[model samples]
Target: MKPEIIDHLSEKQIQELCQLFQSTWWAKGRKLPDVQRMLNHSDLIVALCHHSSRQLLGFSRILTDYVYRAILFDVVIRDNYRQQGLGKILMEAIINHPDLQEIEGLILFCQPEVIPFYQKWGFWGKSDRLEIMIRPAAETELLQEKAGSLMN
Candidate 1:
C-alpha cells in the first residue's frame, strides 16, 4: 500500500508531528507549541502519511525564497520505513516542486553518517568559498542573552 503526501497539516497532525520528532535525536525534547509555531513559519512542508491509518511516515520541510536559495530540514522517515524508497519520493517532491524548480541552490546539514544518503541527491560537502554558519537561530535564546547582559 502506498502513503499519501501532503503539504498542509491539521491540529491533530501537528500533535502527531510532535510525536514523530521524538523519534529523532536532533529534535528530541521538541515541544508541541514550538512545533506548531515552526510549522506556521515554514515555507514548505512535505509529509507522507500511511494510506489507511494516516500516520506520518516521512517528513521534510524547506525554507526557500522561491528563486535564489532554499534550506532543507528535518528529512526523516519512520524507523520502520527506511530503505523503502520513501525518502526518494519525498526528495523528488521537494526538489521538483513547481515553485522551487527555478531556484538556484538548496542547502542542508546532516550527520556524517547520512552524507552518502544526501549525496545521492547532489548534496556535496566540499566548499572552499562558502560554508554553512548558524547563529542561535531561536529568538528566545537571543532574548535571554539580552536580559542577562542587562542584569549584569
Candidate 2:
C-alpha cells in the first residue's frame, strides 16, 4: 500500500503520534506533549497515513535550519505496522524533502542492535574524533543548582 505522507501534522495527528511514541520501546515510558506543544516546538514534522483511510501509521520530526545539519527524532512506526517498509519510506521522504536536501548532514542515535537498520540510510558508528557525552536530567539540574549557589 502506498502510504500518504504529510509534511504538516494536524492537531489530532500530533496526539496520535505521541500515543505511538509512548508505546514504543525506544521512548522508555516517557510522556510526550499534546498537539499544541508539538506544533510549537517542532521545526518540521512528518507523518505517514493510510492513503484511503487516513490512519496514521508512522511519524518523524527533524530539527534543522535547512542547512549545515539536521537531527531526526521521534521516528516511530506503529507496532502492528513494523516490517512493512514504512519506516524507510518515511525516512526517505524526510531526507529527500526539497527544503532539507541541502542539509550538510543528518544525525540520529539509536540502540546498538538497530545500527544496521540506520546504516542502510548512511549512518555509521562514530569515528575516533567524535566522543559522546551524556548527563542525566537529574544530574544536570543538581549541577546547575550548585553553580547558582556558588555564584550568589
Candidate No. with top TM-score: 1
TM-scores, all models, native as reference:
0.85, 0.80
TM-score of decoy 1: 0.85
What local lDDT does model 1 show for residue 95? Answer: 77
lDDT of 1 at 43: 98
Point out where model 2 deviates above 4 Å.
28-35, 135-152
Candidates in order have lDDT scores of 0.82, 0.76
Clashing pairs in 2: none
Across 37-88, the per-residue lDDT of candidate 2 in tens digits comes to 7557889877799887777899888888778988888788988999999989
TM value for model 2: 0.80
For candidate 2, give the lDDT of residue 147. Answer: 40
- C-alpha lDDT (0 to 100) for residue 144 of candidate 1: 53
**Can you list the residue pairs that collide in candidate 1?**
none
lDDT of 1 by residue, 1-152 (tens): 57898998877778888888898767767899999999999999989888888888888899999889998998888888889989888888887888788989998877778889888888887578965544454669655563444233
Give stretches of model 1 more than 4 Å off: 137-152
